[model samples]
Target: MHNIMIICPDQSPLKESEKWLSRYGFHVNTSATIEQANRYYEWSEFHLLLIDQDSIASLENASSLLPSHLRRIVLDARPSLSTGVDSMAQGAIYYLPLPTDSETVLKHVVNALEQHDDTPQTDEATPSQQSDEDAFTLGTASSGIIGQCAPMQALFSDMRKIAGTDVTVLIRGESGTGKELVAKALHNLSHRHNQPIISVNCAAIPDNLIESELFGHEKGAFTGASTSHDGLIYAADKGTLFLDEIGELPLEAQARLLRVLQEGEIRKVGATQSTKVNIRLVTATHRDLIAMVRQGLFREDLYYRLYVMELLLPPLRDRGDDISVLSQMLLEKACQKHKRPIYHYNRAFDKAIRSHHWPGNVRELENAIERAVILSPPERVEAANLKLASHQSSTQQGTATLTQQGKTFTGTTLDDYLKYFVQTHQSTMTETQLAQSLGISRKSLWERRQKLEIAKK
Candidate 1:
């Protein structure tokens, strides 16, 4: 089930929404006060969040100040993303008008977390699984997100709590953190598990059409309105809606969303009558929402509405457990997907995966494994067989830029870069780590040192 937090000054509507969410298998926490919301953020990790528009305004910088990868659903009085489109574009995943019926809203929540693409239906597809949905089959994100690091242990615990309730969750972090996976885990465990989980990328969607995409339209609603249409929010009816990259939503849409959330209704494009819905909302983003609010690019009220129970996903580097575990998992999946028999990596290859910073997190790890498997023989994956551009270049004279901040000695030999990189990650390396860092055999490493006229450590 999902753990949801509801933050609203209006208790009656929030209570009713909680009850409706309960029907779908969610555990919800209700908090009207900012203090309670702050307390919840400190100790809990919620999967989905439902916020009153006014509350969003109040908690402007709350999510930006929190950790990363939180899923949130917002109830806007204006019920549009125009005003706070920057918020969604910055990183909150989905922004929708608060629905009157809890069930309908729950559907939206499900849709938001599950449906990012429209997949053509296949005859072989089962009834319980949607054609285009990419959900992780409930509770599976926990499998990949865990880490042995204490920070990760604590983070996972928080995630469990976040997943346990329906709270407006704001996730803040650098790019490549495990935010989306955390959001999915929350939806899987929530009361609204049976419905679809839909997601929208605020940063990816064009600004002009975002409003129409969220609230839907009646026939003749816009220039291309050939027929009546249901937007992302309505598609997620009876489900969980995940808005990723929420910080980027445009300012005008944010105002409309604020109104819809506050009033618990939405007026679709070209439709005078408001249609009621039930849904659980989850939002995620990598930007600093509070910072944007301060800059006047985000609506302060909308920020408060979404800050009820923010959850942060630690980066892969911060979660060492994920490094090894994810490598192994991706290795297997890559082998299977590529029809390669290679399963085990040589010592050099294993060390490479562990040592890399994994700037793209799990996504990066998966790609690395796929590349290795694709290049390997049918029965084995070895270090040399792997095609890492970094590793390949390191073997040559080229250097790889490892971080931001323009700290670069571009012409330095690959060997120097490796030494620098290894020195930087001393915690992950032991005194005998040079061979591993260079992805070469101990004997070959010595040969390279002599051939390249390199100084031995």
Candidate 2:
């Protein structure tokens, strides 16, 4: 049995967690203070440390007091993006918001311990091997995706496990969350790496041409089909076919795609015979596909086929310090692309980046960095160069005080505020725009609308 230490204030919930962990047969120790934690650490060999925010004065102090060899998990009673980022920066392997159930906590602990055990001991590794391992840990894995945050690290781990298999994958996230990157990484890591990976943007293609483009056409099959042509599906034979924005595909096209997936073959328009193809299907969408299926816009059969394996990408706001890391990486690339000298950004630029809720995710960040690189002076980039809109300014303008019937309301309650803001803005703004303005997910907005009986305009 492995030894584990829990550093937390004498809270009932955490104590309950301790009991649950002990029931699983692991040797567990609980410390109520930093001094006590240090004492326990010196007295016993612990493989993992679970520290709560209230146990120490600050993350910096907690990080300093903990041993470097032990895998650390930080729990926060009140979690925010900044706090989570700081905890990760302090070398915690995981940062979890508290009030989570013991089962969830146990799952994280088990996963962390398994990861620790799987890691090769570096004491006897050669310098080159150590360097390679360090690079992988730093998010320089063969996938070439950059991320050091716990969510991304976990995503990379999942990718490695799923890449070797031939199952269909559905990548889902808000736009600009790098779904394509995940799809590309999967193709690069799969057994069909040598085969061609064809990408199709279903939304970008004209509906009239989508069928012909995907399934091909025989000579004189249609007015535009002057010559026989192979479709994207056939082009991806023995390779991978990536269908981005699959949610936008027409219902007719969806049926044909479903048939292709089921039969592992395709027949061109007006073709008498079917052509066999062996390919992996990977799809991505920023839209709510289930909602589309309900509205009868998307085929349910295709949805089920694409849902074999789902990979969800966390948006930029939830990714914490990855914003800083990605910004710096994008800055260098932007400078090189524009043929400009490397330029540093001021603290104001950094603050603006951290403050803004990037609804566009990494794509927005890259555009902002490139814009700043092109517009800023040779020495430093300023907040103005980024051209980011102030969320606070918008909120202030929208939430101004109102008075009626000899009484004044400042929107004290969350429901009142949401009802007022959403009802007031739903007339002029689209659903997506309203969600972005309110700093919430579209699903959350819809749920709130249902709860408050606020109908969409």
- List runs of model 2 lying over 4 Å from the truth: 1-114, 118-138, 389-457
Give the C-alpha miss distance for residue 408 in model 1, angstroms: 17
Local distance difference test scores for all models: 0.62, 0.76
Return the lDDT, model 1, position 342: 39
Q: In angstroms, give how far residue 369 of model 2 lies from its true place.
A: 1.2
lDDT of 1 by residue, 98-161 (tens): 4456554765577545533222222244544432123332212324343434455456557656
lDDT of 2: 0.76
TM-scores for all predictions: 0.55, 0.62
Q: Which candidate is the best by TM-score?
A: 2
Q: Candidate 1 — what's its lDDT? A: 0.62
Clashing pairs in 2: none
